[model samples]
Target: MTTDPRTLIWSKSSYSGNGGSCVEWAPAQTTTGIVPVRDSKNPDGPVLSVPTRSFAEFIAGVKSGAFFAA
Candidate 1:
């Protein structure tokens, strides 16, 4: 399901901080149970869409520091 990222509403995480490395996601698209994600620095770049359950799991991993480098 290819879509123009510009057409969807995007939101950056409050934890994104001042660092330039950040991602934006279209929460509004969750109505379809799929979330579209893209780099905040590159709005015109490619978008990655994932299932809502997968997105939730990813967020849980982030919160649990599962992605942090040991």
Candidate 2:
């Protein structure tokens, strides 16, 4: 059974459109414990589904500047 990703409502990230660092996420459908992420640049591209816990960790890291360049 294949699921259509278009049916999912995506929201633009806060960092979107800033220095080409944009990302979109499907949070409403994340009730299933998996978060869907796709490039804001290419909506028709393949999606990356990460576990909710992992997504949270990644977000926390972003907030904490864990992935920021020195």
Candidate 3:
């Protein structure tokens, strides 16, 4: 499914408080089962379209700290 990133509303994580390192996602566009993600610092940058289930798994991993160094 092709989507115009400019038409999507992006929202950043609340946990990103005062951090320059932040990412944004378009929940509105996720209705089609595709999650659009982009750097909050670079709105005009490239956008990544990930499957809804895959994005959910990725979020779970983050909450589980699976991405942190062991």
Candidate 4:
């Protein structure tokens, strides 16, 4: 089933802090095993739909600082 991006609720992490560089995701999308992600600064921009498992791995990487530069 196709879902409308505008109809889904998007939210960012609390750790996003004061920076406007955060991304938002629609938890409601998880019902279909798809995670919808989009830039908070560009709500009208393109949306990325990632598999639920892939999204979870990405989050794990973020928590582990795998993407951080030494």
Candidate 3 ranges with C-alpha deviation above 4 Å: none
Clash list (residue pairs), candidate 2:
none
Per-residue CA lDDT of candidate 1, range 1-70, in tens? 5656788989997667676678899999988889998888888888899999999999999999889745
Clashes of 3: 0
Q: Please provide, for model 2 over 1-70, each residue's C-alpha lDDT reduced to its tens digit, 9 standing for 90 to 100.
A: 0357788899989887665967999998678888889998899998898889999999999999889666
What number of clashing residue pairs does each candidate have, in the order they appear? 0, 0, 0, 0
Local distance difference test scores for all models = 0.86, 0.85, 0.88, 0.86
Which digits, one per residue and each the tens of the lDDT, describe model 4 over residues 1-70? 2888889899996656576567899998898999999888788889999999999999999999889745
Candidate 1 clashing pairs?
none
- lDDT (0-100) at residue 32 of candidate 3? 97
Pairs with backbone N, CA or C atoms under 3 Å apart (clashes), candidate 4? none
Higher-TM-score candidate among 2 and 3?
A: 2
Give each model a TM-score: 0.86, 0.87, 0.86, 0.86
Q: Per-residue lDDT of 1-70 in model 3, one digit per residue for the tens?
A: 4988988888997657675678899998888999999898889999999999999999999999889744
Those runs of model 2 whose alpha carbons end farther than 4 Å from true positions after fitting are none
The worst-scoring run of ten residues by lDDT in candidate 4 lies at 13-22
Give model 2's TM-score versus the native structure: 0.87
